[model samples]
Target: MSFNPKDALDAVRDIATNAVEKASDIVENAADIIRGDIKGGTSAIVANSIDIATHAVDRTKEVFTGEDDDED
Candidate 1:
């Protein structure tokens, strides 16, 4: 029996396994980054909407109360 063919096959298998593992890790990291960005963007949009609504309400109240200072 010879030790050359078996050793070569084992080395090739090890290289393929390491490549697959590295690829998996990269994909997982990318997914996490995308998810975080989406969440942050949603929160910012909600906050801006709330601020606009509050300003609109204040303006509405002012319009209703009026500002004529010379009433008899």
Candidate 2:
């Protein structure tokens, strides 16, 4: 039973990746509930969903790549 730093870091990265995905789901659902309460808010809700998804993808990429993608 040897301590492997690479394995530890990989495990941590996996956990972080899963967390980010779950958080994004929660935020998207919350936006639905919040926007649903208002009348004629379908467009706003859809836009919010897209925005959250884009951010989640970017964050997940950063987590796996271990760096931020600042390029447009």
Candidate 3:
């Protein structure tokens, strides 16, 4: 059998194209998962910060109004 250069090149090209496409899909999926995780983490941080701020404000108010003096 004679080797056809054009057919060999076409086969290589097809294989390379498929590999690149699969790699791109994997990268896209990974990026999506990372984005979701970051969003969830940010939301949790915001909620915790708000809770901490509220507690701080309540404590400050108590201190300023002499309510904390009773404990001392």
Candidate 4:
């Protein structure tokens, strides 16, 4: 059997193209996962910040009012 250089080069190109396509898909999936994690972390931080602010405001009102009422 005789080997043709042109055919061999074409086969090599096809293999390289497939590998690059698969690698691109993997990178895209990883990026999507990272984005989701970041969004979740940011949401949690915002929620916690709001809770802290609310608590601070309640405490400040209590300190300024000087009333011994069980409301708040």
Candidate 5:
């Protein structure tokens, strides 16, 4: 048996490259599925989240200033 460092290095590089490519494909496929699922609900979810956040900020401001903007 002959010990070849170059051959061993080449084999390791090949394995790493293959693993990365497979991982990338898996991630891309998962993203596609998620996009399909969220296609209809994503907009509504985002809108509701924005509204809630805005209301929270407004309430925080009123609490700090002790002034209600609605009375204006």
Candidate 6:
């Protein structure tokens, strides 16, 4: 298959967006951690962990497909 530069750029864009999301999550979580919103040995920790993973996945899909949760 011929290499398509547009597809390559789109893939890179998705990856970049994912990185940005992760960075934002880190900052937000750090604050939550300090504020005790993300305490250890609690469901808050588990829920936050799941949220981090789900957001990364959802962000990737949105970047690649141009559709968001609102459209679903």
Clashes of each: 0, 0, 0, 0, 0, 0
What's the lDDT for all of these models?
0.52, 0.61, 0.55, 0.54, 0.55, 0.63
Off by over 4 Å in 1: 1-3, 36-72
lDDT of 3: 0.55
Using lDDT as the measure, what is the rank order of every candidate, best first? 6, 2, 5, 3, 4, 1
Which has the higher TM-score value, candidate number 3 or candidate number 6?
Answer: 6
- Give me the candidate number with maximum lDDT: 6
Q: Tens digits of per-residue lDDT for model 2 on 1-72?
A: 455567556656765666566567656666766866453345555665666567667665555565657864
Residues 1-72, candidate 4, lDDT per residue (tens digit)? 355566556545654565565556555555655778666555555554565555545444444554324554
Model 3 compared with the native: what TM-score?
Answer: 0.40
Off by over 4 Å in 3: 35-72
TM-scores of the candidates are 0.40, 0.44, 0.40, 0.41, 0.43, 0.45
> Distance from true position, residue 10, model 1, in Å?
0.3
Q: Model 1, 1-72: lDDT tens per residue?
A: 334555455545654565565556555555655778666555555554555555444443434454323353
Question: lDDT tens digits, residues 16-52, model 3?
Answer: 5655655565555556557786665555555545655
Tens-digit lDDT track for model 5 on 3-60? Answer: 4566556545655565565556555555655878555445544554565555555554
* Pairwise TM-score winner, candidates 2 and 3: 2
TM-score of 5: 0.43
> Root-mean-square deviation of each candidate, in angstroms?
31.7, 7.4, 29.4, 30.1, 23.2, 5.4
TM-score of 2: 0.44
